[model samples]
Target: VSRGQAGKPPGGPVPSCPPSGTKLFTSTVHCTAVLEGFERLRQDGLLCDVSLLPGDGEESFPVHRAMMASSSDYFKAMFTGGMKEQDLTQIKLHGVSGMGLRQIIDFVYTAKLSLSMESLHETLEAASFLQVLPVLDFCTEFLISETTLENCVEVGRIANTYHLAAVDRFVDGFILRNFGALSQTAGFLRLPAERLERALASDSLKRCTELQLFRATCRWLRHSGSRMRQAARLMSRIRFPLMSPQELLHEVQTKTFPRFSPGCHNLAFWRASNYQMLPPMQPVLQSERTRIRSDATHLLALGGVLRQQLLVSKELRLYDERTRLWRCLAPMEAPRYQHGIAVVGNFLFVVGGQSNYDTKGKTAVDTVFRYDPRYNRWAQVAPLNEKRTFFHLSALNGRLYAVGGRNAAGELATVECYDPSSNEWTYVARMAEPHYGHAGTVYGNLMYISGGITHDTFQKELLCYDPESDRWTQRAPMSTVRGLHCMCTVRDRLYVIGGNHFRGASDYADVLSCEFYSPAADNWTSAAPMLRGQSDVGVAVFQ
Candidate 1:
């Protein structure tokens, strides 16, 4: 018995609904009342339209609408089993607790959340999958900004793997700044071959020479096609002097025997194997009968020498500008490049430049050929370690400082100081940057490096390297980036003259622009331009 319709016939058993107004009719009426209530609501809704407002606590409605607007495939990939639950758990357990599954869930649900390092790697993967570039960029910037020497190798590896160019550049800068420290632990720095090759091209030889890096260099040399051949040739030239005469004989015998004598029995091996059997010969012989001349005229030519009389020789001629004519005087033993000569006491020391080459095609001589005018002959002094060409060699504090130059490598920052008294070369502080086609002049104790090309890039920055501290510090930027520039000290002021400007591209013909740098203020100001645009020029102060 249940209440129905408007009345339920007191406490009597619920009568069965009837047709018309009977008890059965009342049951049918109750059923009709329920049906009519629902029909009235449907009629009103069909006639009226409902609209949502912002303050109704339904702001999330638009978001939901947007999600529904997206394709089914995208929604499933982002929020479903596509992202592994195990990965999320691992991320939380290992240091990324700050960006755990909650944040990830928020992103999946609302498509937005703040990211941190703990969640950075995960976010990057998610963003890549979701095609969100802003999030990806943020992650890359975070990695680059937080990179350190301790983690540079790991960061660089990741950057390279993902082809993040900007991150790679940042790592390179860090490595360059801490080259010496990193070199000590090069055994741990692991990077790709292309990255290492780019580093090598930029004069990163110090880094490349470390214990582990040297192995990488060897691998690069072995596999590099033409580069390998060139390196082999250069190394062969370097090893020539260390080989003994017996060893040299063996090398020649081995290499030439196949072409010269086919029936040879390992002549190279025999030459190297047996050195005691080699014989020594005496000087050449001349018969007394051949000493006499065939004619009296020829005999007269030797009469002076035969009489043992000292012969007067003609002295060397020199130009007497006051007299406006040439006159006889003591002459230089050889005509040499005025810029290539250095004077110490009574001796004129001549070091090598772009001079004669040995059979191996190495330019500049290691032999420091000395010309003593008093003796009128050239004597060889102790050789330099390597050939230096087109470099600035100056005397500083009684020793010769060979600054920057073009070596087997394009440009070199390798500085070597030569002690005239000891006749020895000792390594000195290297320059802050590798430069060639630049000029160097010593003012007091500081050596200034002006405009120069560093591996094809023009640098307008002026740097000063102090020998006392063995460090280089940036001074002031140059007014213009010019290479092959002439630098001279005029009345205690540094004057830079007629140098070419390279726009890091094509070389501009020499410019007449000139500037002077003041050491006191560490500033450069415009100066009078040179009368002519000169390239490969030299300046000397005469007292």
Candidate 2:
């Protein structure tokens, strides 16, 4: 590992596979040994060919030409091309700090980097100048994982400067999730008009009403003369039809705003005012601007037991963060529990689970329902090939995946996938062992299932499913064996919340402890435990 690297390398036998000509081989000892030797040689100033200087009045590093050229495109171009520094023994790098350059050189030989928020900017500058893609990619990933409301705009600026395209997903999602708060940030006023408009157009930008969104847009326009030019473009993204008529009349119509070509601004206000005043003509007058922005999150208490009696609930309720209250929404046509819910695009998908029961004892249904929050309605879609309960449903790459869960028959190992485009379910590879009472979520385009029941025992095993290969591979397990837990991804970290763990034959206890998994380090670390022990509980990220 490189100096100051925070994580420990995964411990295991390093496997090496040789082509058809080889008989046998040992742990890829040669690769590590050779790299270590090179590192030692560099440290000892042996076989040094070039001296690379970073910035001005800083220490210079003596390194091999082949090593520098192979690892960095900037060095390759400088030393291999007809540049003036090609034949020179020493090269000076501008705008790259001594520490940053040293870190980059160390990574060239060690394949490890120490990236922290404090040093990330300088390292990104060095990597950008040196054209070290892996380092830039690492920085981008780190930015995506570490970004919060406070520094998200700074991260966005860094990404734009360095061309770290990968952080866009995290940034976009963060802005949508924190639109209400982010709009008040100083950096929000600096956001490009197109980006803000695109975000406003999404149905998932919630937690703020159309009035607040309009007020925020007005403030952005008032920030500078340049922003005033884009008022029409951005204000058009606000759904005036969703705003209250009183707000339209008092807040919008009364404000003396900037003028537009041929008085377009006044017309925009007038049109919005008309949208609210005319109810009968709303259908034909409806546009993207007329559509209400759907809330990105919904924590509903679905069918669950209250006491001794089984309470099968179809009532869909929503919890309001601002008022600290709950409200009812459109309920499901059919009542069920143990089902899996996932959101893909603008629609919410409900997968297989247990339905109403008779004297037969247990019942699991294969029914799949699609909920469109845009209209607050539910429509039955394609059913799963297998009727599974206690399963996990995850949306990956625009497809829904139903993982291991059981029915009245028995626990199942089979897995199936649903493609919304075709409205069909198809079987995928089965799990190594069937599991239930598990929790699963998607992170980095991969599906992770963890903490389930297998063979009548708690399963701490974590399994990762790759859609491209249609296979399930084992990952590091949780510290405590648990089931009936909640798993979710915060930023890029995988979190396992409250669950149940068994001590003995009849000693079952609710797990108050929680832990998170790092797919990069292939390790688990304890997180803040739940306030109270819970099982079969729901978990959703607030922001």
Candidate 3:
């Protein structure tokens, strides 16, 4: 109907319609302009006002209110939130040192910091007071990474003061692992009376014999001459009954026998005269003895569901490295599918999992039990605080960590830890998000959780938890979204085994594909595929 418009196009000789192509346009941007501008302002001392007085000495530095507020929560509140320092041109910091303030100012301007071990304590103190979390985190992580038995006690004290759970855990692990050499350490000998008693009580303290433990305790008491009153209390923690009759007489009955509690004397005498083992006098290194003497090059595929049938698998098969063939071992106490099984020392622990058989309305259970392969028996241990299914089960620093899973209220992010020494489950830090059907494995001190289901959808998340820092950090995602997978560590490398793979449109048959992750490289590589597609399967490493 618009005849005039149609005729205009013909008159322009088809007006050379522009070639079908996109116009290219770009404007140059200075990548570092903002940072450079800030640097210039700092060098020129432009518009700078307000002087900060250090805690000690006569040094004072002029700083910009806006810059200080932007960088620190403490300064932001003081300057912009109408604190007393808002109108005051000069403010005194009661705790920060002049050198520490300089470092903090440099970091605020340049987003860079040079921290030395000598200056770390002062810097961290100032940063914590100023609510500068970045520098505080940096200092904490550095200290955690550098922790050793030599400084573990000192680090423990510092970590306790700061409420740094991760560092505290690292210190505890260090003490337990190196307890054999504890007496030789001046730090252990000099530990405050309260700290020494607590450290000695840990079941994880690794000593070969009760005699050695007694000697170490005596040495610590003698070194701290003021702790004579604590001798009986400290000696009670030592397992006198674990000593052989000869050792009981020669080690304790001969030396500091009078220092021990009267109850300890009766117990030591019973062991030395009678050959009966007492419950309280059990060897602290009993687990170690079994681990050292046993050959553990056998991989066991525990109970799991097979074609809708719960393999309360009585006939357990293990891959024997020497025979290169699967060998049947003793079965579990009952059929368990979707359960967590991990080897801690000489015992294999079966943790929480589904307990019901109904495919429609199965329930999660908190039953925990341990199996000693040498004895071919299963015994119930402590139960979890919460019943969980599809949770992450990992052993780190000689303790078991159970992360997020499905509970009575549906998905949960709660985390729990099991200390074999205490034989009790305790709550630890919760995960950032609820993870069900996730694959978790430990490499060194860190636990890695890959793709999993959260809130009914498959997730591409990859998270690493640092037990020493009690913190979690997101990592590069998995190549494919998956859940209900099996993960195992072999030679420090992590391998994600068969699991249900989500292809966006729908879930594919449990994938036979596997992927290998290198923690050092922070990357994943293709691995040999499994013989069959599998989901919710158990994996074990034989070495």
Candidate 4:
């Protein structure tokens, strides 16, 4: 430490400290002063030598080389690196708009931007070209929020052109969700066959019926004479077997299928024949064309109460197990918390949960909404026979079982099963005791419900339901009594992780301890405790 301020920083003063101690301090006010002073100099063309000219020659701006180089990597490389323009007082720039350059230069000086929806894309172009990271991030975030069906095609194309992988992936989702609508638009015809093929291959392609999807493929191919060369590749992605016999007949009636080669005409015959023979054999006799878009699954986070129960959230997120990344999906149509989710075939079902935002008084729902990830569409399904919250909805044997949970009336002991085949709920043998907040999963032929709360009392009993026998047999009990924890099975063992055990009246403590159930041994064993204790946690299996 210099005693008399000989080593003082260029920007400002430091707060006084003990004579023996050295202290480092930062001055935001001084930082702001430096940028403001440079901006004034640039505006007045003072201390400025470089004059930048855009390729269009619409306008030119005089600026300081050091100022421009400091904020932009592109300018830095051009002005300071081995580029020929490094020592040049005047430089020519291309592929950026005059207005965009003007805006970015101002933002660089003032640390403020006047961004608008109309100017956003143009600004994004300049930012990408200039390698101005901050403005680029701002533009990306803006597009993420403002992108819609009307503009998604343009946004997606631009993202693809720029090779912005994250932005491209997100915008691609928007494009797929509205592919049906876009297919009717001129933009659909303008899309390259390679891009069209990617969309058609995705199970996430939503909203378009099979017939519409088939027409979309043919439409893009017909738009350009050169496109016919890629017809087979584009057409192969359509799930022909998913079309109804009536729809297939309509395709024949429409006569829209074109034959580039002699063999192209058999598409209809093979489609019809495969449709008739394979309708019932579906899923079992799967091929690229016969396979439904949705058979693939990913980890999903459904709506729940958020922000200390002050708000009910409709946000839906997908966690890519492979990439280990979380991305937003179309949210549920309505808000729900304390809801139960189950998967049946290519669909995900959200059963009863509370709707009221107020924690003091929560309202339960009996409504059911099924989500099709292929199209990112949500449709109402049969409502549960009984409304429930903090319940267990488990899928087994092509059916959904909604186990006991709470309602406005209180904890429920009744149970019901929903058959997607029939779209109706039927009474299932009830648990001997009513409990809410229990975690349930299916292992083999039976559904296992473990650890729940009955009123204020936490439950430890593990009950296994045999659908064939219509009975729940008591299995080994958990080592700890807790509810609101999550349970999952791996390699035939049930892992119960983090919930809360009751302490005393209206008081509970987080259960850091975890346990697993071994069906082979019919007993429980302790597992390593979590570093941090949590309640009402969610667990999922990646494989």
Better lDDT candidate (1, 2): 2
Local distance difference test, per candidate?
0.52, 0.81, 0.74, 0.79
Q: Can you write out model 2's per-residue Cα lDDT over 385-504, one digit (the tens) per residue?
A: 988888888889878899888887888899898876567799999998889889998898799999889877898999999999887899999999999899999986999988887888
Q: Could you tell me how far off, in angstroms, the CA of residue 20 lies in candidate 2 after the best superposition? A: 13
lDDT per residue for candidate 3 within 129-186, as digits (tens), equals: 8988888778778878888778777787878777677777777777767777766877
Residues 1-543 of candidate 1: C-alpha lDDT, one tens digit per residue: 666556656566577865785353346576556435434543444321222122213221112212311322333453454565312311212322223323433443344567665666666554554444555576688888888767787788877766678888988877656655654454333545455544434432332222233333444444535444334322221122122455445543444323333343244334333422321100011122111111111000000011143321212333444465765433333322212334443344555454332211134434455543323445556666666655666666666676666655456778877776566777787886777667877788887878777877767778787878878888888788787777877777787888787544664777688898899999999988878888655666543
Off by over 4 Å in 2: 1-22, 81-84, 256-262, 295-543
Candidate 4 at 437: error in angstroms?
24
What CA RMSD would you report for each candidate? 28.8, 19.0, 19.9, 13.0
Q: With candidate 3 superimposed using the best TM-score fit, by how many Å does residue 523's alpha carbon deviate from the native?
A: 46
Report clashes for each candidate as comma-separated counts: 3, 0, 3, 3
lDDT of 4 by residue, 1-543 (tens): 445557776557877875686779998699899999998898888999888887677477899888889999999988878888977887877878887888788888988877777897678878889988888777777777877767777777777776667778887777787787788888777776667778889877866777888887877777788877787676667776677667666673346664742345476457656745632223234466654665356789978667764788888899886688999998898998888887766567888888766332247889988886655778787799988888888989878899998887888889999876567888889988888988988899889999898866899999999999999899989989989899988988999999998788778889999999998899999999989987775788877
State the displacement of the C-alpha of residue 386, model 2, in Å, after optimal TM-score superposition.
43
Task: Please give the distance, in angstroms, between residue 462's alpha carbon in candidate 1 and its true position after superposition.
Answer: 2.4
10 residues in a row with least lDDT, candidate 4? 278-287
Candidate 3 Cα deviation (angstroms), residue 78: 1.1
lDDT of 4 at 96: 80
| Native-referenced Cα lDDT, model 2 | 0.81
TM-score of each: 0.37, 0.51, 0.48, 0.53
| Candidate 2 RMSD to the real structure | 19.0
